[model samples]
Structures are given as C-alpha cells and as structure tokens.
Target: MKAVWLAVGLLVASAASAQDYAESDGAMLRFLDKLTSVTGDVTLSRGQAAQFGRLVVRLDSCRYPVGNPASDASAHLTILDDATQTDLFNGWMLASSPALSALDHPRYDVWVLSCILPEAATEAVEGE
Candidate 1:
C-alpha cells in the first residue's frame, strides 16, 4: 500500500509539471473536409471566427511548449454548422493527438497547428 501511494503521488506531481504554453494573440489551424476530400489551413486571432464550408470555427486561444514550436499544440475552439444552426464542437483539440479530443462532424475535421505569439512575447523570447 505504501509503495502504491508513493507511485501515485509521483505520477500526479509529474503530470502537474508537464509542458503547457499559452499564446495571447492568435492560432493557426488545419481543417480537413472529408466529404469533399479537401484540406486547408486558417489563421484566427483570439476570439475571432472563420468560416469553412457550412461550418463556422472560432478560436479562443492556442498554446505550445515554452520553446519548442513543433512540440504538441492545443487550441480551444467552438465550431457551429450554419445549415443546421447547431454547435458541432466546443473544446480543446491537440495537434499531437488530434483524435484524442476531436470534432465529431461527418463533413469536417479540425486540429491545431500552432499558436501565433504576440509581438511582445516573441520579442521577449528572442531577446533572451
């Protein structure tokens, strides 16, 4: 019992210290339309919305690792289908693991690419 409790505690501590970065400006996302077999990328500033086919996607924010841009990225999104007037997805999508938390739309699939860093954040990091 004592050994099991120690292992659990270590796992929790490591998970808490895992890499997570938040961007303030905008996010870039790649979306695939499975029905049409077409794919494209879109950039959206925080709180801004863009339309892809009949689906409207809004980005709340995006995040990547502190220094590794190619590392795992995640974006908070809200997607709505105008034709049906229903929200299809409203949650975070991970770039490294798109299928983990994904939009369940038959026609469209959306995933994060990277978080666009604000000028201030960029400058600060580059200055170091």
Candidate 2:
C-alpha cells in the first residue's frame, strides 16, 4: 500500500511540473575562450552540433517556463573534447544561474542563454 501511494504521488508531481514548462527546438548559448576571454553566442537546434576551438558542443533540447519563456532557459547539452575524444560535459545547464551546473574546462566555458522556440510555437504562445 505504501509503494502504491508513493507511485501515485510521483506521477502527480511529474504532471504538475510538466505543466509549468515547455520544450523548444533549439537554444542560444554563450561560449567563452578562457585563454583569450573572447565570448560569442552559438545558436543550435536540437540534434545540431557546433565546434568551438577544441570543443564540440551539441544541443539535444531546451526548455523554459511557460509563463516567462525568455526569463530562464535550460538545455540538455553534450560537449566533447576533440583532441581527447572524451565527453567533457553532458548534462543540463540553466541560464539564470549557470555556475550552479557549469561546464568545467581549462580553456573553454559554455552556458545557456535562452531557449529558441519554433515559429509555430512562438505564434501559438502569442495567440494564447
């Protein structure tokens, strides 16, 4: 009985959380060349990849709160180091507080800036 109740509670929580956010096709990210302190924006669609110096950054998806989509963004990213053939970072990064879940690298730093929705999605939101 206890297990059954726990499962029910988990489902309820997930459903509630889902209603608070919406998924997007792409995300805008900022990258810093630590050595030179050069910074720029990189926009990536879901499943698209971009190279920055020795790093390959890929965006899997992005999400933002429904009420204030531009205020905060979170994205699933997969970063690879080409020279080492290793994945340096593979997780979600938030725009509002990047240091909370930052990419640790000696020569490069990346963080989410905003989630980019498709034209249809943007229109739908505006229509509402």
Candidate 3:
C-alpha cells in the first residue's frame, strides 16, 4: 500500500511540474487529531513553522496557477514529530489531491487547503 501511494505521488508530482505557477506568500492548512476528533486550521507563511501537540509543521513554499486561486494549490512542507525528532512528511502536497501524498501518522492528519497568494499576484492579474 505504501509503495502504491509513493508511485501515485510521484506521478502527481511530475504532472504538477509541467504547469506554470506563481509563488504564494503562504498556505492555509488543516489538521485533524484522529484520536480526539479535534480539527483546526492554520495559516502559515512560507518559511514559517508551527507546532501542534508534538508535531512541528513547516511551510517551505506555496504555489498556485498564476492568478487562479480556484485552481490547484501545491505546497512543499516538512513535518516533524517533536517527540522523536524524526520527519513524518517532507514533500509537496496537493490541495486537490491530498491522498496522493499524505502524512502517515497514526494519530494525526495534515493537509493543505489553499494558498494565500501575495498582493502582487492580485495586482498582476488585474494588470492583465
């Protein structure tokens, strides 16, 4: 099952690479505490990191189709388990296809929801 998911993730990553995207200022992500059924969202700027419970989540980069928020959102993330100081996930995760590359934690679920595009992106769209 893990291998299959890895294969799917690679395919999705390759497909996404073919598109033109604009860098976003940050990303909006969500997490679920599987054991407690608690859910929450976090807004993280690129290069920012946040901690939830024993997990430390970092936003590396965020991007979307230029001027198209309704389109796909992709974010590069690095998540670590503070309890063990080991990485849980370190890759790009797609908002439209979260299952393609997901965190394999036993008690937590994290995924990208959308990107917080920069003001420059809005202006660029308006200029066009």
Candidate 4:
C-alpha cells in the first residue's frame, strides 16, 4: 500500500510539472508573436542541439504618433531543455526622450522573459 501511494504521488507531481511547463511555453510564443508584428528583420539562430539557439527581433524601427512617446525595443529569446527553468524568452524595450533623434536614443527600457510550455517546445523557436 505504501509503495502504491508513493508511485501515485510521483505521477501526480510529474503531470503538474508538465502542465506548468506547457503554460510557460505558451506565454513565450505569444510574446514572440507580438514582437514579430511590431519589429522587422526577425533573425533566428539554432545551436547544434535541438534545444539551443536564440531568437532576436529588431524593434528599432517601431514608430508611434508624433505627440505620443516613441521607443526602440529588442527581444532575446532563449530556450533550454530543462523543465524548471521557465523556458526563458526575454524582451527589452527602450523609449527615448524628446529630441531630434529621440528614436535613436531610449529613455526607458523594459525586459520580459516567459517560460517554455509543452506547446511551444515542439515548435521551431529559431529560424523560419
């Protein structure tokens, strides 16, 4: 009876972990979608292994209303094979002050990283 209980506990823990992973990955994919839409010249790098590489999106060209604030953004997405690492996908956005070339400089910068979930794990994160 004790052995059975232990096995059941392990199974439950495994399932929970998997679900968490999936949710995290999903979030990253969503972020990527948003970044791609806003930025041009999306570049992807793949490592030797299936789990390596970085997804870089250039957000310098993003434009906003003249009166409104303008900013430059960049996203660095990294994926690992581990389940506990949150499958990090990070983004950095910078806003410049009011200047002739404000777009060239950034006043504020933001960074975000999301975990990797099951759905995103199967998809090709880097390259086309």
Candidate 5:
C-alpha cells in the first residue's frame, strides 16, 4: 500500500511540475438544477460572486496552461448555501475532470467550463 501511494504521489508531482500555468482573470461556469433540468452559464471574474438557485458561488482564482489555454482549466471556488447559511464546498475544480473535485449539492450541479484568459492571451488566441 505504501509503495502504491508513493508511486501515485510521484506521478502527480511530476505531472504538476511539468506544467507552466497562467493566471486567468475569470472563468465560465455552468449551473444546473437537477430537479428542473434547467441550466445556465455565467462568467465570473476573480473575487466575483454569483447566485445560482439558493447557492452563492464565488470565484477566488482561475488558471490554465500558459500557452495552451484550451488544454485544461482549474479554478478556486467558495460556495455557500444561502438558505442554510452553510458552506457547501470550497476547493479547486478542474474543467477536465470536474467529478474529481465537484460541488456536492442535492439540487444544483455546478462545474467550470473554461477559463477567461487575460487580454493579451485572448487577443493572441483570437488573432490566430
């Protein structure tokens, strides 16, 4: 068991170390109401908060691969249930693998779609 865990840790360390990331100004997020089967999209800047259903979601930070913005996206989030006044989730969510770190809510499902790059990066991508 120890050996397996060590191997997994080494793999994760290597994968994380090899990537150079750029800080994004914001992210595009999607919210879904499981009961109603309704969904909506919203763009949120860092430190911005939005209300979806009864949940208040705040984006703390967003990041992506430096030169490959489409490759992957990750965002730090703080979510709270306004009605219950309880913290539902607070962690990093990955666009590539949202299930790995997801917001656990009974009626609402939220996930990151992509990162909103900086002006320079956005221009570069658009120009290409």
Candidate 6:
C-alpha cells in the first residue's frame, strides 16, 4: 500500500509539472503575439517603445523545460531599419518578483517593447 501510494504521488506530481509548463508556454506565446503586433510599426519612441521591441525578440527565442516554471524566464528585443544599420531600441524582461513554480500552470506575467531607428529598419530583421 505504501509503495502504491508513493507511485501515485509521483505520477500526480509529474502530471502537474507537465500541465504547468504547457500553460506557461501558451501564455508566453500569446504575449509574444501581442508584442510583435505592437512593434510592427516604427512610430515607437526611445523609452517604452524600444523596450517592447526587445521583449518580442527575446520571447521568440525562449525555450523552457517540459515541466518547468517560467520563473527564470527573461526576454530581450531589438529593431533595425533595413535601409540604415541603426539600432532603434532594446529592452529586457526579468522576473523580479517571486513567481509561482509550475505545480499546475504558469503564474508569472511579463511584458516588453523595443524599437529600431529608420536607418536600421531597412535591414532584414530576425529575432530569437
């Protein structure tokens, strides 16, 4: 009976971890989509606008464990105008607050933005 119960507990824990990872990934993806849309334009300014661009790039390159929380997840974004080799903006996201570990799903929320200069905007941009 003891062994059976132990096995059951482990199984449950494993399942919970998997669920958390999936939820976190989904949330992050959604957030990325939004960020991309916002950065698609070059009207952003130097402060917050630049930060959002960095966030989109960072999130796009993110990779998480199958059953891990995004507590340590961070992102950065950068934009460039193809015509000019100028970097418009850059930003980063770090989990400053205590984020929930995935027991069932991700619980942390992150946002970021960044923008590129008109000169760099002409370059073929790639973010990861």
Candidate 2 C-alpha error for residue 42, in Å: 1.1
Rank candidates by lDDT, best first. 5, 2, 3, 1, 6, 4
Model 3 / residue 40 / CA error / Å: 0.9
C-alpha RMSD values across all candidates: 3.3, 2.9, 7.3, 17.0, 3.7, 15.3
CA lDDT, candidate 4, residue 21: 18
Q: Write the per-residue lDDT of candidate 2 for residues 52-111, one digit (tens) a residue.
A: 989999999899887766678999999999899799999999999999999999899999
On lDDT, the leading prediction is 5
Query: What lDDT score belongs to each candidate, Candidate 1 first?
Result: 0.83, 0.90, 0.89, 0.29, 0.92, 0.33
**Model 5 stretches with alpha carbons more than 4 Å out:** 1-19, 126-128
Model 1 residue 118 lDDT score: 62
Find the 10 residues in a row with the least total lDDT in model 2. Answer: 117-126
Q: Model 6, 6-105: lDDT tens per residue?
A: 9999999999865542212211322323423432322222222222233322222222233223234333434343345454334444333213211111
Which parts of model 1 have CA positions greater than 4 angstroms off?
1-20, 118-128
Candidate 5 similarity to native, TM-score = 0.83
- Superpose all Cα atoms of candidate 5 onto the true structure and report the RMSD in Å to 1 decimal: 3.7
Q: What is the lDDT for 95 in model 1?
A: 83
Q: For candidate 6, what is the TM-score?
A: 0.23
Q: Model 2 off-target regions past 4 Å?
A: 1-11, 119-128
Model 5 over residues 37-123: C-alpha lDDT tens digits? 999999999999999889899999999987777779999999999999799999999999999999888899999999998778778
Q: Give stretches of model 4 more than 4 Å off.
A: 23-128
* Residue-wise C-alpha lDDT for candidate 4, range 1-128, written one tens digit per residue: 99999999999999875443111111121222242334222222221112212332222222222221112212233433244554333332222322322212122212322322233333433312
**Decreasing TM-score order of the candidates:** 5, 2, 3, 1, 6, 4
In terms of lDDT, which candidate is stronger, 1 or 4? 1
Please estimate how well model 6 matches the true structure, expressed as its whole-model Cα lDDT. Answer: 0.33
List the lowest-lDDT window of 10 residues for candidate 6.
Answer: 97-106
Per-candidate clashes, comma-separated: 0, 0, 0, 9, 0, 29
